[model samples]
Structure formats: C-alpha cells, structure tokens
Target chain A: GESVGLHLPTLSVQEGDNSIINCAYSNSASDYFIWYKQESGKGPQFIIDIRSNMDKRQGQRVTVLLNKTVKHLSLQIAATQPGDSAVYFCAEKTAGGFKTIFGAGTRLFVKA
Target chain B: DVKVTQSSRYLVKRTGEKVFLECVQDMDHENMFWYRQDPGLGLRLIYFSYDVKMKEKGDIPEGYSVSREKKERFSLILESASTNQTSMYLCASSSDRGSGNEKLFFGSGTQLSVL
Candidate 1:
C-alpha cells in the first residue's frame, strides 16, 4: 500500500530562525502534494501545495519543494514565530484519485 | 467562507457502546471525508462519500461505517467502541472539480475518549 511518512517526529527552532520539515512518499503516481498545519485542538489547515509538474511553490512565509524522482517533499518556513508552533503534515494525492493520504505529522516548536 | 461543522467538540463513551459522529458542510461540496488522528499517526482516512448514498472505505475503516443520505452531511458510526478508538476525529469537504486537485476544507475536530 502507498503511504506518506515524515522524516522527523519533532523539530525545535529559534523564533527568528528558519525551519525545514521533510517527508517521503512511496507512491510514484501521486501528482499533487499539500502541506498542512495543525494547532492544538484543531483540525489540519492547508498551508501550501505543489503539483508534480512544478518543483517548488511559494506562499507567504512558507515554501514547498517536491522531488518526484526521489519521492521527497519538504516544507520550509522563514522567520519562524511562536505562532508557527504546530504539527505539520504532508499529504499526497494520486493521479485521478479522490482520496488523499496524509503522513504522520512533524511537530514544530518555535522557541523564543 | 466554507464551514465544516462537527456536532460535538468532545465526547466520552464506554466500551461496547455505539457512537455516532456527525459532520455538516455548508459549501455544498460533492465530497466529504472522516479521518482519525492519533498521537503518533497523523490522519488516517476512515471513510469518504462522493455523493449522496455513496460511501467508500478508506485506509483505516475497521470497526466503522458511514452514512451520507444527504449531500451536505456525512456521518461516522462506531458499532462497538473500544479504548483504542479514542482519538481526534476530523471531517473535511472538497469540491467536485478535478479528481485530485481538490483542496479540503476541514472542521475543528471532535475528540473522543472511549473508556
């Protein structure tokens, strides 16, 4: 079965520092990828997404890079703030498929 | 704004009891999904409905069933709740556009604790 997994369970960074979270997916047919942030006691919220055709997509303070060859995905956050402390997850959508599979989340802690 | 509302924010049930989790979306989306979130596991889809009266099992669908008699509401039912069933349940809805290109709008979530 195809699955998405995160590289780390937790990441800690300074408030003003940059944070990078890595994810690896097993399904080669997945064409759409998304990154979501979940605050405590809340559902996952979409942050950014990238298509298989594109290598990278940029948002306000976040960036998503996708490497289909290696089946790796990464989310980078610039100038991390305390509000950025949350669990981040990477999700993959297969071509022509309706369901999206989500990876185990990586907890991000922005320390002041 | 698209709003997905779960009936309960927190629920407590005992073993062998039947549980129902309800979700309603106001966006008139064609797809609705139910997922469970655990401590180590992120979100595992239990079931999804693409249309009224149409339901499909997802990655982790054991001990669960779904109902979608209406397009705007999807329900998840637990036949016999167990301790392991204690987790955060999330409901999401998406448009009927391209198959995989749809972005999900999620509800806050319902935290269930089975004792």
Candidate 2:
C-alpha cells in the first residue's frame, strides 16, 4: 500500500519567520508531487508542484524541495503571515496513474 | 481559471436516505474525481471517471457509487447515508494530456451531515 504522510501534525511560527512543512511518501514510482493549502471550511488550494526530474521548485513566496532518494518532500513558506495560517498537504502522483495520493496534512499557525 | 463546481455548499439528510452530490467542471477535463475529507484522515478518493460513462472505484469506494453520463458532470451517490458517512466532499478535475503531471483543480467542497 503506497501512502503519503506528514512529519508533524501542527507547526507554529512567528509572523516574520519562515515556515517549513515536511512530508514523506512511500511510493518510489511516484513522479509528480504537489503542495496544497486549505483554509478552514474550504477545499485544498494548489500552492506549488514539482516533478521527479527537478529537486527544487520555487513560487512567489514558497519553495518545494524534493529528495527522491529519501522519499521526502518539504514546502517552505517565506515570511509567514497571519493569512498563511492553514492546513498544508503534500500529494504524490505515480507515473501513468490518474489518482493523486494526499497526506494527512500539517496545520500551520502564524502568530503575530 | 479552471473551475470545478459542487452543487451544494451544505447538505443535511437523515440516516438511510439516499444522497446525491453533484459536481460540474466548466473546463473540458477528461478526468474527474470525488473525494471525502475528514479531520486527520486527509482526502480519501471515492470514485473517479476518465471519460464519459466510464468510472472506476478508488481507495474508499465501498459505500459509494458514481455516474459520469456527461463529460463535464460527475455525480457521487450514497445509496444509504449513515452518520459515519458525514464528511466534506470535494470534487476535482484535471486534464488528461500528461500522464501524472496534471494538477488537480478542486471545488469549494460540500459539507454533508447525516443524522
């Protein structure tokens, strides 16, 4: 059974500090990874994504780092703000697969 | 923007009642998925359709069924709703151009409560 899991259930950071959310996946055949942010009562929103060919991908204020050897992935949010408080999840897609497996997610709290 | 729209934002039904959750995507995506999200359990796929009139069961599809009569519409059906089945249902659509590289576009989700 291939699955995706998060390292932490919750993470807290100062408003001006940086935040990192870690995830580990079990499927070695997975070729695509994505990070999603979900606010309370809303569906998960796409934040950033990375392919197996690339180790790191950066967005406007977020970065996704992937380590294929370790089957680990991380999302870094720079300059955490109050609006950044939400639940973040990591998802993996296997090659030639249609379904995406999602992690349990980590709740990020930013304190001003 | 790719839009996946769920028919309802909130729904309430009694136990043993049949429930229908409808999802429509404006984008002509070839793939559509239905997932249920619960606290600490993440999103569990119920069913997915790759094309019209074609469907496949997903990870947690024991108590659910699906219909994809039209290309843009996917429906999730609960034959007999139960209290344990109460959850937030999410609908997503993605293009079939890339095998595993397509990003999912999700709807706001429908919160269902069974009593």
Candidate 3:
C-alpha cells in the first residue's frame, strides 16, 4: 500500500517568520513530487514541484526540497504573511503511471 | 489561462438519492480527475479519464462511478448518496504533455452535503 503523510497536522507562525511543512512518503518508486496550497473554500493550487533527479526546486518566496534517500519532502515559505495561512499538501507520483497521491495537509495559521 | 469549472459550488441531497456532479474544462485537456477533500484525509482520487469514453477507478472508487462522454466534460455519479459521501469534491484537468509530468489545473470545488 502507498501512504503519503505529513509530520504535523497544524502549525502556527508569526506573520513575519518563515514556515516549514514536512511530508513523509512510503512509495520508494515515486519519481515526481509536488506541493499545493489550498485556501478556505478553494481547491488546491500548485506551488512547486521537484523530480527525483533534483533535490531542490524554488519558486517565488517558496521552496520545495526532496530527500529521496529518506523518502521525505518539505516546503519552506519565507517571510510568511497572513495571506499565506492555509492548508499545505505534498503529492507524489510514481513513474509509469498517471496517478498522483496527496498527503494529509498541514494547516497553518498566521498571527498578525 | 486554464480554467476548470464544477457545475455547482454547493449541493444538498437526501440519502439514497442519485446525484450527479458535473465538471467542465475549457483547456481541452487530455486528462481529467475527480477528487474528494476531507479533513485529515487530504485529497482522495475518486476517478479519472484520459479520453472520451474512458475512465479508471482510483483508490476510493468503490461507491462511485464516472462518465466522460465528451472531451471537456467529466461527471461523477453516485447511485445512492449516503451521509458518508458528504465532502468537498474537486475537479482537475491537465493538458497532454508527452512527458507524462504535466501539472494539474483544479476547479474551485463543489461542497456537497447529504442529509
């Protein structure tokens, strides 16, 4: 069975601090990984993605790190703001398949 | 801009009633998927279609069925809605990228409550 999960269910951060959300996956053959952000009443939005060939990928104010050896993935947000408060999820895809599995989301609350 | 739209933002249905959830994508994507978002469980794929008249069951597809008669439209059918089926349903589509790693574009989602 394939299981993707997060280390934390909820996290609270100050408005100006950085936030890091972690995920652990059980599928060793997963070749691609992605991070998504979902706001209240909205669907998940793609943040960043990294392939197994790459260890780190960065976007505007966001970074995703993939540790294939440990089967772990992480998303880091720099200078987190109030608007950044949402549930973050990490998804993984095994090669030679069209399916992607999402991890239990980590809810983040930003204090003003 | 890629756009995925679900037919309803909110729906209410009674137990044992048949329900239809519609999704339309304007981007002519080759792949469409239906997923349910629940607290603590994340997004669970219900079904997916790669082309017209084609569908494949996902991990949690036991009580659900799907239809994809047209390239831009995908539908989820619940033969007899149950209270357990109440959750946020999301629609997503992705363009064909021969590389098999294209990103998904998702709809705002439809929250359904079964009483």
Candidate 4:
C-alpha cells in the first residue's frame, strides 16, 4: 500500500524556461532519493540523487531537492532543452535495503 | 560503461506457455534485479540476486521465478504466461551493501506480449 507518486502526470515547458517536477512518497524512513530520465523505448538513466542528510543535490543541469519532513521530492531542470524531453521518475531507496521504489513518472515535453 | 543486456528486445508468447527472460551484466556487480514496468505502476521488482545461487523476492514476485547460477547472469522464468504478464521487463545491476548509493544500471528492456 505504501507508494511513491508524482504530483503531475505530464508537464509542458518552453525550451529556454525552467521546469520543476514534484513527487510525493508515503515512506518517511527512506534515506536516499534518485531522479531518473527515461526516453521512449529506452531504459531509465540516472540523473541526480540526494541523500536524506542533504536537502538538495545538483548535477549537470538538474537538481534534486528532498524534503523528508513532508516526504516530498522534486527535480528541477534549468533552461530545459528539447533533449530534456522524457519521462522523469523519482525513486526512493528502501530503508536499510538496496531496493528502490519508483513513482509514476511525469512526462516532460520541452517545446522549442 | 556498465552494460546490462536482456536476451530479447521484444517477445510474444501464448497464454499458458512458459517464458524465460534472460539478463546478463558485464559489470561484476553483486546485485542483479528483475523488474516489470507498467503504466501508472512504475517499475515493480520481480526478483533480485545478491550472490550466485541466491535470490530474494521483490514486491511483485508472484507468477515469477528467478535463477542466478552465475554472477554475471540472472534469469526470470514465468511458469505460465498470462495476458497480465505482458509488459516491459528491465534488468538492472548494482553493487552489494556498503557500495554507497551506487545507481542501478538498467538494460534496454524486453517488451513482452502474452496472448
């Protein structure tokens, strides 16, 4: 019954603008979070991750924000590009386990 | 680059037939996982192996069995394939405990259809 879910199913943003995708998780004890980018017909690729001890972590052009208090997670992309269009997934590492639970992905469509 | 390869890119099977999904990892990761990706359900783990000949049941392991005779190979077996079993199967590998949040490397996936 415990699940990780996203606030939106789809998001449309301009190529030059910024985009924010939100996720809500039911498990509070999850210590690690990761954001994955999955293109059509391709496997999920690691984007960025943030540990419970850290509130936020940044990658190439993306940032992952974790809020353990609200069991919320978010991914922010700066200056979204056309290549950034894909399904974004937020995964939570099971406490004391190597398994991770992924949320219903949010499809990001960046328009040029 | 870490590469996880699935045996098939696409497969179709008849209901009640046996199905075998093979996954092989080039990396020497100790952990190998089998997952099925479905819309709205995201990715649900079917099984995982932390060592050769050792396995663990995942969230949705029903209707599925796994084998890990070798460290570089993991297999998912569907005793009797059903229409509900049709979905994209993804194979992933990761390091064992204490490897630190090492990300899971996924295979291209096999799209299976049971009719």
Best by TM-score: 2
Q: What lDDT score goes with residue B55 in model 4?
A: 97
Question: What TM-scores do the predictions have?
Answer: 0.97, 0.98, 0.97, 0.97
For residue B73, model 1's alpha carbon misses the true position, in angstroms, by: 0.5
lDDT for each residue of candidate 3 in A1-112, tens digit (9 for 90 to 100) = 8989999999999999999999999999888898989999888899998989999999999999999889999999999999999999999886657788999899999999
Please tell me how candidate 4 rates in CAPRI terms.
medium
Share of true Cα-Cα contacts across chains kept by each model: 0.77, 0.71, 0.62, 0.52
**Per-residue lDDT of candidate 1, residues B1-115 (tens digit):** 9999999999999999999999999988999999999888889999999999999999889999999999999999999999999999999999947668877889999999999
- Give the worst 10-residue stretch by lDDT in candidate 3 chain A: A91-100
Each candidate's number of clashing pairs is: 0, 0, 0, 0
2 or 4, which is superior by TM-score?
A: 2
Interface root-mean-square deviation of model 2 in angstroms is 1.1
lDDT of 2 at A92: 96
Clashing residue pairs in candidate 4 (N, C-alpha, C atoms within 3 angstroms): none
Residue-wise C-alpha lDDT for candidate 2, range B1-115, written one tens digit per residue: 8899999999999999999999999999999999999989899999999999999999999889999999999999999999999999999999967568888999999999999
Candidate 1's C-alpha runs over 4 A off are none
RMSD of each: 0.9, 0.8, 1.0, 1.1
